[model samples]
Target: MKQATAKVSHRLRGAQGGMEGRFRLVLVVVMAGVTLFVLGRGLFEAPDAPDTFVNGTSTSPGGHRALLHLLDEEGFTVTSSVDRLDVLNENDFQDPEAALALLEPSPQFLDKYESEVRGLFSRSWRPPLILVLPKRHYHALQSDEDGTLVLQEGIYSIDDSERVLQLAGLGSELGVRRVTGGDVIEPDSPYATRIHDESDEAQVLEFTSAASPWRKLITDSRNRTLAAVNPLTRVVVLAEPDLISNRFLDQGDSAALARHVFEASQCRHLVVDEALHGMATRASLEYLAVRPPALWALLSVLLLLALFAWREATVLRTQPAEVDARRSREFVIEGVARLMLRAKDFRMAAQHLQQRAPLALLPSRAHVHAAGVAGSTSASLPGEVAERLHQLPENDGSEEHLIRVARRVAEIRREVSLSHHVPSARKPG
Candidate 1:
């Protein structure tokens, strides 16, 4: 008994060992899946740049984003507008203390949308408008490693300075000429802060023309006007946007000078025009959508989520009921027949048939009459059935005899069923 018990325990331990191996395989597969996920995330994440001219982005070393940040720090609400002038109204520029700035807008943008500028001037409540002319042309290049595009910059005068001036409604009155001299500023002016450019003498942006109806604000060492204002239109033009540009902002009190620019506006709110910067446009949206890696990542996430939901639903669904284990009467009959045939027990099979059918078919009519308790003296169909079965020729353990006896029994049953109706069927409705 003890040996048998030990054998059973060993088998149980074997089964447990197989289950443990399977569990380890499952754990290894899960760890491999997680590793792949982390690798994919590292390979596909987007690059983040600290400096970009894009509105609402942080001031970087290469862009004029610092002005926006400075204005925000001074407690003035700064709003960036992406829509065109046609969609904007007086309410957009209606703050009691509001100033508007157009930063390095391209000449092409000004020429194509001249009517929008005119619309702003047409309004009754005229707010101060500042125009910072474009000075550099940067080309965007694709990075080889990540296939991301970065801007490659080149400095030059705008392609069409005259066209831009005309669109701003200030024609040749405010001309632009490249300056070869050092930094030009008016430190004593209230609009000028104590911040001085590095060296107090670096190559800078200086104005070449300062015509009537426009007051000159700053002049270069050569005495050329660098910054001016048109009181009639409330427009301020800064020849060089360097003082506010991201790269020059952190050097030698440039931030202080930037604060002076905002303070000069005397407005409670500042508006930065981003429409000319190539953002919030249908073209940009289309461009991002076409990038292969971003699109692929989005599709992969959706597929994984769908699979997880399907698996969860499958696990939660109820299982089907177990099948019945006991055999039916027909199954028993067929099983017994097969057993008898295999054993070549013809006599026993014949005996089984007689005992199984005759008893159920026979009735108790004769016994009831002997006890004087029957209303009808005729025997039931079962009694007649039993009598007919007894009259058939007996089987002699031969195949022919067995077949004949079985056929006679079937015929008797069929005749009795046809001649006698069931008691329930015979009752009047």
Candidate 2:
């Protein structure tokens, strides 16, 4: 008995072990496939979107497309908000690890959207806001063959930036420092600090508010603020846009600086606000919800659920039951016939029978053409059933009316079926 029990237990254990191993393998394979797909998308995704000055999604020479890609490689999930500032109040953005980047805002943008821009810092519950001040002053040289504005540009001087700052309502405290000769910034430090490759003429911009008492997050040798943050509000101001712009992204420590900005902001999720860049967008979860792998997975789940519901939603009709008013008999009526003659079901059925009557009485090819002519055609319920139908009651659902209609249908069906079998010369009555 002990030997038999042991053998049975051993077999059961082996079966369970095999099942567990198979399940684990399936899980790992699924996870690996997802990881590869996500990485592949990040690696091969489109570089940019259409927009104006300092677009984070635009790959133009003045855009931050490269930096966005770099941020993705560094494990940051970047999205562009073209529609709304729904993120400001969204629960996901409420996390401390989320940041909103307002790319180089020209003076015109600030003039138009200063309230909306300032709202980012004013909100009680918000993500870290990084405001990158404009570096290039744009002047259209000429329109290209594509009607695109070709700009002749030079860096915005400290005094030149005052117009934008004043328009942004950020006060004129910040300045852009231009140093002809400088040193290589140490990699040991954060990206938000000091000007890198200044000897190469790196543009450095600073933002500070005496009222906010923000500590310098990015600065140079003279401690001119390149970026700074308010300890209380968690707002980050990156004065220079060059550090992450497409033109300078690959030059020196800019890529590293971009990564450090993410780390220093304490945010892994970042949104590049493009609504102010003239890209019409609204705040919506659809942009994030449809992100790859998740979309496919959602569709698969929906399909599975649909199949399961189809299989499990079996609705067995109740067996029909009715008895004659005065008889020693119990007759089982069909479910539909037994239903009360209400306006809904029976009225529709009566109309259907009326429409089918002429087809039943006429030869198949007789009812084909318009203007009293005829042609040959055949179809299921919807097509060429009849040129005309027997008139049906508009509202009456009385038992007598139902019986009369039923008897007429039965006669028509009998005549048609018999006519088909009898002879080609025989006509349906």
Candidate 3:
């Protein structure tokens, strides 16, 4: 028993070390690929760039393209709000014709357009306002050829979410709270399962504020509300953005929950915010690749690879025999021909010999035309070559038969080369 346990432990240790080494190799390859991609992006980038935020212009894990497409497919006319609050006020809102989707606005945006936001949302006669909170800070990576910035793998942060609540006048009734150390979202109620967490890596949203009179739409496993609605104000807040985001909409019941939220807005027309995500400037390759930690990590990986290579070169070995420094093209061709013959690929060897055959064996195009016997003249070089290949006898396709066919093709090429005035490729020059 002791011996068996010891062997098992030893094997486990070896497997663990092998896994670690494989992980390191994969990481190094990924880093090298990313470096090449960034360099290439920098070289061939366009001047203008597109917006890849929740602006419905992208289908990346971070963007809201899926939601927009779903809404459109469901027969709802979804429009985009690229301008500031001026466009909101210009629309007919008293009859609830449109629902405004305020998606992941930066604190800077809230501060700049605070009054405009208040004016639109605070109105008693306005459409339903849906606030989708931001949970992370993302740096735009590559841009499409048409110049659209792609957002992915952002660093998670819960900062400034409260500021968004304050801007929308919900700071008093509800607060934005974050709970770390949480993985999947579990629901407390049946309706809450509509926005269920299927992903193990799903982020959690907690409410720090005292319980308000607002109706809870969804909650975390701890029964803390993640989504709520205030019927009086006609305002709805979704604490977690991934429920409607491209990343998790198709996961679990997210799509159904998202549609339910939109239907609750009670508006036929919808407007998604794009101006808040900073689409004013184009994203450059330098912006994506020139980060301090990333640069350091890449440099460290490269240094490690170089050290490994150097260590490998330090091993002692028998001195290799030196050969002639130069060789003619004919010598290289002959060597390749010999390798093909050894492989027993008769067809390939014959085709190669045919390609290298002299051009002079075939009658000139001008001479063929001058003869004025065009209908009878099937003696073109390509025609004759095809005929020669066709004339090759069928066999059981054994290695011996293949070798015979190759030899015959080689002889034909040699005869054609001798008949041609063209400089022979096989000649020792």
TM-scores for all predictions = 0.48, 0.46, 0.46
Span of 10 residues, lowest total lDDT, candidate 3: 317-326
Runs of candidate 3 exceeding 4 Å displacement: 1-52, 87-89, 92-95, 142-152, 180-211, 279-429
Candidate 1 — which pairs collide? 51-60, 63-246, 97-268, 207-226
Top TM-score hit: 1
Clashes of 2: 8
- For candidate 1, write residues 327-363 as lDDT tens digits: 4566778998888788886777676676666554443
Candidate 2: tens digits of C-alpha lDDT, residues 274-315: 766766443223343346756677557656655644543464
Q: Cα deviation in Å at residue 46, candidate 2?
A: 28
- lDDT tens digits, residue span 67-162, model 3: 999989987778776666645545534445678888767555566567877776676656678888876455577889999766556534555776
lDDT against true structure, model 3: 0.63
Tell me the spans in candidate 1 whose CA falls farther than 4 Å from its real position.
Answer: 1-62, 89-91, 118-126, 144-150, 187-211, 280-429
CA error at residue 352 for candidate 1, angstroms:
70
- What is the lDDT, from 0 to 100, of the residue 153 in candidate 2? 70
Instruction: Looking at model 2, report the run of 10 residues with the lowest lDDT sum.
Output: 319-328
- How much does each candidate deviate from the true structure in C-alpha RMSD? 18.9, 27.1, 26.9
RMSD (CA, Å), candidate 2 to true, equals 27.1
Best model per lDDT: 3
